[model samples]
Target: MQVLHLSTSDISGGAAIAAYRLHQGLQHLGVTSQMLVGKKSSDDKTVFAPKSNFSKALGILKPTLDCLPLRFYPGCDITRLSLSLEWLPDRLAPKVAQLTPDILNLHWVCGGFLRIETLAKLNQPIVWTLHDMWAFTGGCHYNQDCDRYTSSCGNCPLLQSGNNWDLSHWVWQRKAKAWQNINLTLVTPSHWLAKCANSSSLFQDRRVEVIPNGLDTEQYKPMDKRLARELLNLPQDKQLILFGAIGATSDSRKGFHQLQLALKHLSQSGWQENTDVVVFGSSKPENSIDLGFRTHYLGYFHDDIALALVYSAANVMIVPSTQEAFGQTASESLACGTPVVCFDSTGLKDIVEHERNGYRAKCFSAEDLANGIAWVLQDGERWQHLSRRAREKVEQEFTLELQSYRYSKLYEEILHFGDREGIKSSN
Candidate 1:
């Protein structure tokens, strides 16, 4: 069967990469999967984007125009978190109609790539994957501690608007109206996000399913630590702790500041001198961050091979995220036989089996994080056991082949049900 996936970019962020991997996985299972992205970065023929220069230039300008509505909310703290407005001039409905896929899989289609009204325009059955809380919320990507989304959102905390009829309310109303008639199903990458979506006013009446992200296991498997270190030119003597992502330290949600506090705690507890920190996706700033130990900043690794090398080189991967939809790096580290250390909260709690595969520290506790790190590294025999289980966790539950098969089944079910009942008509 033919499947079409829509995303903002082909392989830019974690969400984009996840979507692209699923497209590849579907192809491996002999399914015709195509990705139509706003900004195409790869040379994959199956992945299509606007070919004309005019449309490509408009693509570059869409994100800026989409945020123009936020200017009305003058009190907003722009750096607090990300916000998306349902404003864009797009002809994507016709584009999708021309492609004529049996099923439409939507990924991170925000960033001005899709207008809010676009969902209702699609003809085929839709499977929308939530990479963040944007799908259910008023405007902000992560509601954080806000529960206003369960009802109609107004006076948004992120927008800093005090009035009940604020920009967020307008956006929420638009979604509530436009999406009421669509043939859509929601898929979340974690149970925590699934719970959040189920509670949201927009999705409360809709069906929401939990499906964890999957990766290529063979490409991320373990390599010799000594060989990995040598390949990356890292020192062999020091035990390594790795942390990375786009804007790894700068992004507030990533919990880099919390990691700094944990590292300082480790230093005072007598483990500073023996350990070094390795970071990817970000380089050392002009004013370097002091994490109580020497830091090695190996910037972005474009391909999977280099990422695998970095994961293999580390003894432990610390994903100290305050909030995460799903921790991709943690699973990738586990696939490489490197234990992960994350808080026992959000989506991360699902990936690490405490003390069996990895350590799940107390939520938002720097001291507990340090304690967990020491626990993982202090016992050499236990480290091997953790490493073995880490690999096994991904193989049994998160392999690419398994993910493709599950998605295939879901697609079949949607098709069968749509025919028996009524499906949304073509635009």
Candidate 2:
């Protein structure tokens, strides 16, 4: 079966990475897959982007223009402004019509790539893989603690709106009208996200399914710790703790503050001098904050192999995000045979088993996070066992082949049952 995937970028953000991996996996399984992206970074022949200079220029300007409506809400917090308006017109529907595939899989089509009204224009079977709450909410991506999206969104915390008919409500209405009858199916990578989709006012009536994101095992497998440390120039004497993501230090949702608290708590228990922190995705700022232990800021990783080496060298990985659609870094760390320590909440609950492959600390508890870290490193033999189980967990459950097979099956079911009544719940 021929399938086409739509995304903002082919290999940039976490959502695009997940989408690209699935596209590659389907091709590996002999299913013809093609990706149409706003930005194509790799030289992959299967991925296509706008060719004309004008189109390329528009792609660069779309993300800024798509968010132009937010200028009215001057009081809205700028740091939390992840809203996308999708008001700009694009001649993408004609391009999609020309390529005409049996299935259209949408992944992170915002960031000025696709419009809310554009889905109905395609007139094809759609499988939307949601990477965040943007697919359901009025404008904001992560709702934070606000439950306004469960009903009609207004007085959005992200926008700092205080009224019911603000920008958020207007955006929500647009989505409701344009996408009311579109033939679309929803797939979430985590059960937590599936629950959110089912409870949301926008997608409550739509079909929802759960499918975990997959990675290449061979590219992310364990490497010798000493050799990895030697190549990376990290000290082999100190026990290393890993933490990082996009905006690893500045983004509040990633819980860097919570990590700071946990590290301080861990230091009090006689680990201040023995443990060191290794961070990627963020460089050390001019003003560095002390974590009681020495911190090494390795900055961003260029590829999966570089990331795998960091994971393989570390004793444990820490992911303290307040909420995540799916913890991609957590899964990547596990694939490298490293135990992970994360709060027991959100999508991360699916990846880390409690005290099995890794430790799931009490949700948002810094003390528990610190204790979990100590427990994982206290005994060398136990750490080895956890490391073995970590790789095993990824191999048995989150491999690329498994994700490809599941997606192919879902595609067959959607095509065979044109009406698609029985394919309601998850596989």
Model 1: lDDT equals 0.88
- Point out where model 1 deviates above 4 Å: 419-427
Write one digit per residue (lDDT tens) for candidate 1, span 1-427: 8999999999999999999999999999999999999999999999999999999999888877888888887887665458888578688999998898999999998878999998888989899999999988888888878898899999899888898898889889999999888888887888888888887988876777777899999898999999999989899999999988577555678888889899999988888788998988887789877889888989888898889999999999999998889889999999999999999988887798999999999988999999889999999999999999999999987788888888888888889867322222111
lDDT of all predictions = 0.88, 0.88
List TM-scores for all candidates, in order.
0.97, 0.97
Candidate 1 lDDT for residue 320: 93
Taking the tens digit of each residue's C-alpha lDDT, what string does model 2 give over 1-427?
8899999999998899999999999999999999999989989999989988989998998888887778777887565577777767877798788787898999998878888889889877899999998989888778888888888898877777698988888888888899887778889999999989888988888888898999999999999999999998999999999998577666778998889999998988899778999888878879878787888889888699999999999999999998999999999999999999999989999999988889999978989999999999999999999999999999998999998898999888888876453245853
Tell me, by TM-score, which candidate is best.
2
